[model samples]
Target chain A: MVNRCLITPARTLLTQTINPSLRNGFPAMTEARVLVLDADPLPRLDRLGARARVLHTDEKSLAERLPEADVLLVWDFTSDAVREAWPGPGGRPVWVHTASAGVDRLLFPELLESDAVLTNARGVFDQPIAEYVAGLVLAMAKDFRGSWELQRQHRWQHRETFKVHGSRAVVVGSGPIGRRIGLLLGAMGVRVDLVGRRERTGDPDFGRVHATGALPDLLPEASWVVCAAPLTPETHGMFDARAFALMRPEAHFINIGRGQHVVEDDVVEALQERRIAGAALDVFAQEPLQDSSRLWDAPNLMISPHMSGDTFGWRDDLAEQFLDNFDRWYAGEPLFNVVDKKLGYVPDH
Target chain B: MVNRCLITPARTLLTQTINPSLRNGFPAMTEARVLVLDADPLPRLDRLGARARVLHTDEKSLAERLPEADVLLVWDFTSDAVREAWPGPGGRPVWVHTASAGVDRLLFPELLESDAVLTNARGVFDQPIAEYVAGLVLAMAKDFRGSWELQRQHRWQHRETFKVHGSRAVVVGSGPIGRRIGLLLGAMGVRVDLVGRRERTGDPDFGRVHATGALPDLLPEASWVVCAAPLTPETHGMFDARAFALMRPEAHFINIGRGQHVVEDDVVEALQERRIAGAALDVFAQEPLQDSSRLWDAPNLMISPHMSGDTFGWRDDLAEQFLDNFDRWYAGEPLFNVVDKKLGYVPDH
Candidate 1:
């Protein structure tokens, strides 16, 4: 079945011929096996017709086929099957690409410590998530969600709403997503202070993203605190009770990053105790947020099913990003958006 | 009680003393009655104490005291008392200003034709409305409203949403509010074309605002179309069946303008027939949107009271704007935001 999916088109050959120096002693460019762990229809790779062999594996069969592929594409980004499947592998795929911004689920010890290279679909989600964050900030301030509820109830409630202009925001994560959020908010007249690894210089959008040490000080002044950081050991549960406690009672928190960055219980407690005004959490510690979670019952909290950046045509963007990298892999060129295995994220320059 | 409110301090004198050449034959500024049509707490004009006589009148007493005041401040902008009281046989205030952007309710023919100069709180509402329009655009594109509803229901349903970046938007009204909306949307990678009275030049915000005539051609191309125009005979009911027909089925309509700009029946029918995707209406022909209105039952319709521009400190802003103008008028200086009486709205330069 997998053999039938191979197609060797002229474009693949053209790429190999153009970069003969990269061909070296590498495996045949047109015969590389491409395994995709897919939950939905993957973007068509007919352009690589017979040049790259493709295979789709579900969670059940994912482990059995691990060693048979030259490259693996984690199309089902929300699944943990790759991590579960990697341990029993005879040999890992030389390259693994996840159709997601974060590689938390795919960052198991075996994969991180292995010789395999990791890349993620980064740029595709940057503006979409930024736009979503901007939307949440406006919606909450205008009490638009309340307006929607009133509309549903056929009530005309006129109330004074908050202002976005001149308001202060501390956006955690100085990556593309956070920077975009800061820029968008800043354009709307919000005073934005983006928190990253260290104080960044020469950044046109955000003047100087403050260092991590400043988060504690920044949190106290933020009316809108946003978390857009990548998940890693050092950053895991970074927004714990101490972070939540530092924020003003009127402040709102939003998490569009990996759910692991926040302590769910601390947030829930904050919401219950009215430590924070509200939150619009698109990511949670566990998604498809289980019915048993106390978050649903918490006051003034907005829960979304982890799709902040999952805009339409996103799958196609991810597929095209992977295809571009695949061509580079065939030519043995350096891949784009390569994650720092030691840092477990794309390290900022 | 009204006599006690007057206080004409020397800051009033500073202007009069400095602009002596301009204060020719004007009525005694110290004894001038400043009648404030107040609904909520009026702005403390204590600075003008004893110099300018002040009277606070509710809707019931407004007509009785209309002839006594030299200047009228329409602080209760929502009331129709000004229109109803204007036709009474009494002397009129020489200068009248409404603490609202649009003065539809106050634009009676007698007042329009009268020599009384009319002004509005134009700049105060501009950015607030622009911010609201941007919020609506992003909310609709990301289906953030649907997510809010799901959050309320405790449902974890993930859905495909649209991208805001690279999307097209046509913002009606090239005034401060519309230009601001165009600028904000453009900042987020949305291609924004602003429509105004005539193609405006030297507009730093919107490079060039398309003439209102171009709206017919521009409507079909927009993914999100925003209306922030003033209500006037030329603009009334412009978004009728023909306009709705011109829009794509996927396009979303948002009206932050006076409700009269849209024909309620046409939009409802369009939404009902699935001719248009959805609408987020903050204004209606009759607001506190009547329960009997079919718009309430219209699918995918988002309704909000006419509070789009009414932010937290908006009242203070409106009051301060009026007070600034009052000082100018006392000095016999040409009042700012003076409406072109013939046009029924502020005419663009």
Candidate 2:
């Protein structure tokens, strides 16, 4: 026999946040108080605010308030508070959502084993990140840094630059973001090889996604080695000294994925030794990278704060996504973008 | 008369230069004396060496030798010697070719009115320029300078960025490069309006290419205004104060075409006044832009020494293109990429 579930009137924010275009489900649903761990002001959640109580907090106050909130909105995905505080319960929330695609920080054993459902802002960042990656490819191939340096010195030096067309790129990931990247690169006449965790076929974006086993063979042939994979036990430190040694000397590396997906020390060493042509990293193992990090001194490396996928209206997109999911949950429907807790990411299929 | 024209064995370079893929048309054609005005070493013409007497000259000695040449190859595309020396009483060659897309420097009245047919390296630079312009757009939107500056200081600062998708763009030349830029930008989801000299329809890349007359209406709505028009009597200084004024204050301007297309003083003024957000210029009114130029200090302005379309091995591509056209000329066939003398550019059709 199936049991009927009911939330108190105070938790309706969960119901209202779902796509408003979706039929209102479970009328008179409880209005749960939402604890928002914010780094900065999020896009105003007018519809959700009208339906539920949202208590804004920060990394400092997140732990103290975790027990009182009925729901947790990890708006400040960069914080580790959720992992640190989840075990301390007044029981954890029934569901947890992060305004980020990577959930490495929220994958602690306790939460992974918990009954809580996890969701992330996925679709919103995919296209933007793909666009960013495309830009990175062109920027590197065109020697934009050299151009910028010349401009700085008021120098007018004309030099030969490499072209982006007909080049080979191996994108490491088979998720929507990775596929979108491949699609955009392919649109520009680049031959793209997409690598995923397992062998796959029949993908429209990547006709036949290669498995991780193919990486060794693929690396040497790629002029562009892009890391867009999630940070999991298998992926963490995958791009190490050995991986760098496998790449062609002229190949460039770009990371729009988790920093842990690459070994920081190894990347630095390779860059310093010129093991690879260059690297453009938008994510780092330790963000707001330590002021003394030697990676800054590595020749031909470009470091960007983790804003590869955050475009002008990104916050709004994140908020809207959450609302849509909330609506589905309110209607007693399964949530979209649900993460496979054991795998540490949402399975593409 | 279908009579075979004989070329003296000494001038074989002129006939041998044609693409051998042309079935060795008009066998034993006239070996015409070929004059190359070069600032740098011209590509070694191995095949042509046996068929033509190649004469290499620099700007200093160009006039002295122009009268005796049967054909002219302006390998020093940047020099004005061709235009300045064309009027000297010595007869001009039947055909002249410049290793560049822009022929402004060679558009003197004497050459245009003469029987000389002109050709240029058109297709080679199209894709490269398109890629460069796309890079510039991303660079400006991503605030690459700020990121570079922060990287220099080993400081990590994350800031919000505008999205490329959904933003509107106005690309001011509907030539191959401009259309390719529009195509790539469109692939990234940006709405682009391509402007040409006249209204055109049914372009596979851009459904409708707007005419210059649409600028007044389109500029104000554009967030990115790109100038890729060639320099001509009708185009010189076209982007003046009035053009800048018509654009949105948040707009960014990119000039990958001839620098003379924009009025330097007006651009600097607009940048200083924050009339437009920023600009990236790969070309200038005077190249090797005078180090003392005030534009160096203009806020939100990026400058490069006119190398947008040149990629590695570009010299080879130019040589090959020239040789292909020469083959057609050798066979008395119509040449490709013939610039309309009256219009100062190759007509799109």
Task: Please list the C-alpha lDDT of all candidates, in the order they appear.
Answer: 0.81, 0.81
**A20-73 per-residue lDDT for model 1 (tens digits):** 454444446447778899868776677566658798889999988877777789
Tell me candidate 2's interface RMSD. Answer: 1.1
Give the Å error, residue A190, model 1: 1.3
Taking the candidates in order, what DockQ does each have?
0.70, 0.65
- Model 1, CA-based lDDT: 0.81
What's the count of clashing pairs in each model shown? 17, 25
Score every model by TM-score: 0.91, 0.92
Give lDDT tens digits, candidate 2, residues B161-218: 7778789999998777787889888877889999999898997878889999989999
What digit string (tens of lDDT, one per residue) describes model 1 on residues B1-349?
A: 0001122332343234333453444445446678999876777787675558789898898888888777789988878888888844337776788988887877788897776778888889887888888888888888887877777787889998988889999988876777778888898789998987778677776677798898889999999988988887888999999999999999999999989999999999999999889999999888668889898879889999998998998888888888887776675455677777666666654
Per-residue lDDT of candidate 2, residues A1-349 (tens digit): 0111232222233443332333355344456567888867675667774446788887877778877665688988899888777745435576788999898898898888876778888788887788888888888888888877887888878888878888999999887788888988988779999999889898876789999999999999999999998888999899999999999999999999998888988998998888999999999888878887877878888999999998887888888888877666654566778788888788865
